[model samples]
Target: MDELEAIKVTFFQECEELLADLEGGLLAMQDGNDDGDTVNAVFRAVHSIKGGAGAFGLEPLVRFAHVFETLLDAVRSNEVPATPDLVVTLLRASDVLADHVSSARGLGDVDEAVSASMAAELKACTDPNAAPAPAAAPVEAAAPVVEASVAVPAAEALIGADDALDDDDLGFDFQPMTITIDEQAADVAAAAGNVWTVSIRPKSDLYRKANETALLLRELARLGPIEATLDASAIPPLELLDAEAAYATWTVRLETDEDENAIREVFEFVDGDCDLEITRGEAVATDDALAALLAGSAPAPAPT
Candidate 1:
């Protein structure tokens, strides 16, 4: 096999390790050892899988993992109490996440309805007022990939005010945020004719629901060279921070020959959760243009 195929194999192998770590960590939490480290470990496992899946353009895997990771973040931040019910729901989510990974690798398939139902249950855990998820239908034989057009109900609507927390008082520092961009490669891609400029601003509810900013950025990188900059201007100081709100936006300059539809497809599942705009443009000047783009208020129009 070529190097690309070999790398894919290694990723799956590593996923097995991550899944194991995820299960063990969840089990520890279930056993009443809900320490910070355990929560972080569980979060990292899902984050790592989402990162790798985004790199490989595994959209379905990334989408579900984002939801799973978001829920874990709420628990880790203590916004959602780590009750037995939440732990049980998270454990089940972990199982579904593993199934998604397996399906991505062509080793197995998962019922879309079941995954959606479980995702709803996980979302409900973050809301004190939301009704409990209805009983899940009995598992049926694995079906074909869920139709991309079918709308999964938005989970953000389930978040309640009680789920929001003051970050300063919580005494928990968030993991430092970073964006990975291959500048040298992007430079070369920019010189080609296929470059595009993409801007994304996710609603505060997006992060509240546990959607991942980093994973989405990584997913865009899968299409071609990407130079991303996080717009932190809107972020309030720690003393004023709302732990559950999304304050940062991203401006990514993507260099790819793929048409607008292809780039838009990267965010298909998150359509309503974010404000996205794509436009054809000259190669991005990494230094000046990236800064200006991130600071600007309006994006250019899409290529006709």
Candidate 2:
């Protein structure tokens, strides 16, 4: 077998491990283990599969995983309450996901009618308003390779989406970074057709989840042209750096007329993993006092 084919083998090997984690986490929830971390682990399992499938151009796996991931996200966010019925549905979805993996491996064909039925059910759990569909789009029986494995690294290799954390010396102090937005320019930028400044500060959990910053930025670029500035000030020297630590932040100037919600969807998957702030116009310092006041976490300023 060629080197590229070998990488595909590695990905499938990783998928088996990930699928095991998915099943374990879902079962934990089903057994009344509604811990936030448990739900996150379950979400990461599906998300990692989706990322790997996308790299391999396995459309069927990616599509089904996306729908499954969405529902898991809702459960994680508490948007969809974890009811007994919901847990059963999640278990069923997990089974279908395993079949997709097996199908991708050229083991056997997946039952299309059942897969489509599960997709609709998963989507409905996330969005009750979604239109019912008889079936999903036609998917290929044998997973095809769109690009050489070397050209696109599998998500499993980049970083684990959900690994148990251990205390290791970071070798440097970690401080959170904030983006400053200029108030006046922001006001003008809030107008139609003006630019939007978005700040993203990812935590260690984001990288732990195997999310790629480049992918998020690429999604943002779809809205309009974007100028991104990386904040590497918090990054320690190589000798002092922690391999597991996420240190860089970004400030992006997007020339788009899209609403804030549109910009938000780009980073939805990493919602709890990062600190995000979106503003219109130029740059200025973020006022901690004002922010606290706005959030209703602190009292208002006294009138002079």
Candidate 3:
């Protein structure tokens, strides 16, 4: 094998070790041994795999690992408490992550539906409003829209489960309405631009995890044109500065057609490691918010 091929093989071998660490750390958390060290270990395992996968251009593995690692990051930062149900979800996510790694290594194909479901579950743990990422199961057009309360118990009692029926089998006609209002608005937004003001202030933990603000800015640029300003006044003097500590904040005015969720997704992996505020229409003074964060004071009110 060539040198590059050998390096790829070595990365997958290391992935095995990382996956083991991920599983072990999660199991420990499930058993109520969830201390700082255990959470950090779990975060590191997913983070390391994500970094290596990006280098080799394994997009599927990288995407799944990114979602998985985001939840772990939230748990590590204590933004999302590590509860029993969440721990169970994390365990299932780890299994899907392993399947991604195996598929990347050409060992087998992962069920796309299952992987999407796991990614959605992980994301939901972080943002409860996030809908499931998997495509909805197709429903037969001819089936009657029976009352959910009555149909569920009736189906359970009669056939033990509900199955799709043909129009002849159902002996009823069903009409469906097509709603286009949301779809039309989305299309209009795609044609017209929306402006968003985003402010980011990174804490020391953001740098500690090897995340870079520059890369985030670059990713934001992919959505649209952005004007970014850096505030370095918070930095202490050179002699007092710590290399691992982050002191810079950024204000970005972005003009894009993307929705708020797209903008938020850019910072998902850094969830609690930084202070981020996204505003549309009138922008808030994020500098005041940053100051409040540093001083442990209430944030300044938004202008009317």
Q: Which is the leading candidate under TM-score?
A: 3
Task: Give the residue spans of candidate 1 off by over 4 A.
Answer: 128-199, 202-304
Per-model TM values vs. the true structure: 0.50, 0.50, 0.53
Model 2 residue 276 CA deviation (Å) reads 0.7
For 147-207, candidate 2 gives per-residue lDDT tens digits of 2112111112212233443466243543332334455545454465567889999999766
Error of 2 at 119 (Å): 9.5
Ranking by TM-score: 3, 1, 2
User: How many pairs of residues in model 3 come into backbone collision?
Assistant: 0
Q: lDDT, candidate 2, residue 272?
A: 71
lDDT of each residue in 35-120, candidate 1, tens digit only: 99999999999988887887676777887887787778888998888898888888989999999999999999787778878867
Global Cα lDDT for candidate 1: 0.73
lDDT of 1 at 166: 67
Residue 179 of model 1, lDDT score: 30
lDDT of 3: 0.77
